[model samples]
Target chain A: MKVASIGLGLIGGSFALALQEHVLEVEIWGIDHNQAHIEAALARKIIHHKGSIDDLKNFDLIVLSIPVDAASALLPEILHQAEKECLVIDMGSTKNDVCEAVKNHVKRNQFLALHPIAGTEFSGPKAAFASLFNNAMMIVCEAEKTDENLKKKAYQILQKLKMQLHFMSPKEHDKHLAYVSHLSHVSSFMLGKTVLDLEKNEGEIFNLAGSGFESTVRLAKSNSKTWIAIFKQNKAEVLTSLKEYQQNLKEFEKLLETNQFSELENLLNSTSRIKEILAKK
Target chain B: MKVASIGLGLIGGSFALALQEHVLEVEIWGIDHNQAHIEAALARKIIHHKGSIDDLKNFDLIVLSIPVDAASALLPEILHQAEKECLVIDMGSTKNDVCEAVKNHVKRNQFLALHPIAGTEFSGPKAAFASLFNNAMMIVCEAEKTDENLKKKAYQILQKLKMQLHFMSPKEHDKHLAYVSHLSHVSSFMLGKTVLDLEKNEGEIFNLAGSGFESTVRLAKSNSKTWIAIFKQNKAEVLTSLKEYQQNLKEFEKLLETNQFSELENLLNSTSRIKEILAKK
Candidate 1:
């Protein structure tokens, strides 16, 4: 199988590496806008060749793993360039815009919208690895719109990577992700901001930070370029989730201000269900 | 060494177990208001004997590891009961209140104010482990107030457990902890509350929650009893940190709402310093 791995960053590079590990006769061609990333990916042997959008028809598969905005912008052109038998899949975080971008394209059936829910705070080719997607959830949006043969091919590859697949509409995918994923990044970023602001005044404050603070702020280290595009594309949903989060925080603060200890305990106890949910996950 | 481990919960039980592992010829006497906790500690071999606070004079050391409010409430009595050679150390999260509680006690010189910056969300004796304190930070507050001989003994035990020690005033400890520790809990709990509230209406929302959400919300599962007491004792400082956090969140929300993408990116990038801080930690 010949695969075009676009945007040779963490996600794209990791996908290429995973494909090479799982597929017996796979060849990955790297295509990245950033020259450094391409060189890094090549040096790491993540891709067999450096390729471009012009050569899309020669490949059996094309994987898009750029920031959400770029993926949405280039997806239609990618699908248009692909051969009738070729499948183009986008692994962007937000799905609705990308799905809508190719909705009316003549080769819409050649496109698959996928979001493998996996990543780290770090980014770029240097951070990529073959096992990044193992045991991770892969949300495939609007799978029915894709050609059945192409969908089957994508499923085979995903299964080989040991990823669990779930299907949803682009709208449902974005909405759920706003609550579960995007909001988490915002919360973590703000937590980091708050602590960083105070750390400037109290130089040794971080010495007291324990595992909880580290875990809570871990996502604050995510690449700003990627997250800015994601936040912009999913602005409405993110704003909604952020508002709800602020409201919840306000309620907690008010309970504490009023010295209502029992109510405060009740609030905390209710959220403790996340333990069981995460355990199940 | 004859040691009395007061309040055999996660912290107390773990301290007892660590002492048994680190100190030669040591016998741990467990004392807890909860009979189940004492039995669980004894069964897990976290403690060797069941004893009461009244017999504190017989022990060479007394370790108090309970909720901050309870620790603050009982420190004077515990110190009064300890013999001159008995070093009484309270391993509570908040320090100022506990330090104040024992300030005028006749046995004040025997008491040490310590906060071990280590724990998991899980609580109770069952979660206790001897290695919990290994390589963790142990903050010693007002060490000068404790008897020199007792402080030396406590330092020896802390070193044997592989804990790094830092000394600061009790007020400084509480103020810094409010920003780095207590505020992180509030942020995490609110994040969990927000997501859980949404999940109630959107039944499958959690299916999309990834490692990011799990990490940011991990502290939501922390024991309500322990946190309520910490927040109560450190209310002034916690409230200050929490307000700053809320302000930061509001500013980020405004930037997003106004389409100030560059400012949003800058904010995220600036806070990314936490990555280095945590790595250093």
Candidate 2:
């Protein structure tokens, strides 16, 4: 199997490496808008060769793992240029826009809208690893739109990577991700910003921050370009989630301000059920 | 050395375990208002004996690891019961109130206020581990108030656990912690609350949530009884930190609402510097 990995960053590079690791016979070609990323991916052996979208005939699978905006922008054309047997899989965070981009295309059957829910706070080819998708959740959006054979091909590869697959519509995917993923990113970024602004002493934060602070603000280190594209493409859902989150914070503030200790404890205890929810994972 | 661990939960139990692991001669006695905790600690070998604060005369060190409210409530009397060379260390999150409560006490020189910057989302004796404090930060407030000899004894135990110690005034410790530690816990709890409220389908959150969501909301699982007490004790500082955090979130909302993509990206990029700050930890 020959694969083309678009945008040689964490997601794309990791997928390329995972394929090479799990699939017995696999060849991955790296493509990135940044020359540095291409060079890094090649040096890291994440890909066998540097390739371009124009050379699509040589590839059996194309993984689009760029920012959502770029993924949407390039999806239709990538699908247009793909051969009948070539599977074009998108691994972007936002599903609806890119799925919509190629919805009416003639080669829609060859396109798979995928969102493998795996990542680290770090980015770029240097941050990639082969086991990134192992035991990770993979959301397959609009799977019915893909041809049966291509869907089977995608599933086989996902199975090789040990990904747990779930199906959801593009809209549902966006809504749920806004709450579970994107909103958490926003909250983490804001928490980091607030602390940075208020605590002028970086040394103090360095000395005082515990594992809790590290984990809570970990997502704040996510790539700005990638997240901005996501927040933009899924604006409505993201806004709704953020509004609810802000309201909760406001209510938390009021409880503290008004000396409502018991009510505050109630709120915290209820939310602590997240422990059980996550423990199941 | 004889150590009495009051309120034998995560911190207290973990400390007792660490002492047993690192110190050559140690006998630990447990004391908790909750009989079940005492039983659990004894069963888990976190304590050798079920003891009481009234038995402080039998111990060389008394560790008060309860909620801040209880620590403040009982600190003075515990100090009053301590022998001349006995050290009574309060290991609660908030330091100001507890320090204030014992400020002018007759045994002020025997009481030390400590805040170890180490913990997990889980609590209780079941979660206790000897290595919990290894390579973790320890905030030592009002160290100068403690007798030099007793402070040396406290330092020896902390050193045995491999804790990095930093000294500051009680006021300074509470203020810094409100931003770095307390605020993160509130943000995490509220993030969990917002997601739980919005994503009615627990299955969706369970399936779609990634490592990012897990880390960001990890602190939500912290013991609510413990957090409420800390928040109450550090009310003024925590409120100020929350106000700044709320303001930052509102600004973030405005940026996304007005389509200020560049500014949003900048905000994210700036906060991403938290990566560097935390990496120093």
Q: What is the interface RMSD of each candidate, in Å?
A: 0.9, 1.0
Worst 10 residues of 1 chain B by lDDT: B52-61
Q: Write model 1 residue lDDT over A256-280, tens digit each, in one string.
A: 8889889999988888788899889
Angstrom error of the Cα, residue A267, model 2: value is 0.6
**RMSD of each candidate?**
1.1, 1.5
lDDT of 2 by residue, A5-40 (tens): 888999999999999999988988888989999999
Task: Work out the TM-score per prediction.
Answer: 0.98, 0.97
Candidate 1 Cα outliers beyond 4 Å, as residue runs: none
TM-score of chain A of 1: 0.98
Note the DockQ of each predicted structure: 0.86, 0.86
Question: Evaluated on chain B only, what are the TM-scores of all the candidate structures, in order?
Answer: 0.98, 0.96
**Clash pairs for candidate 2:** none
Cα misplacement distance, residue A106 of candidate 2 (Å): 1.9
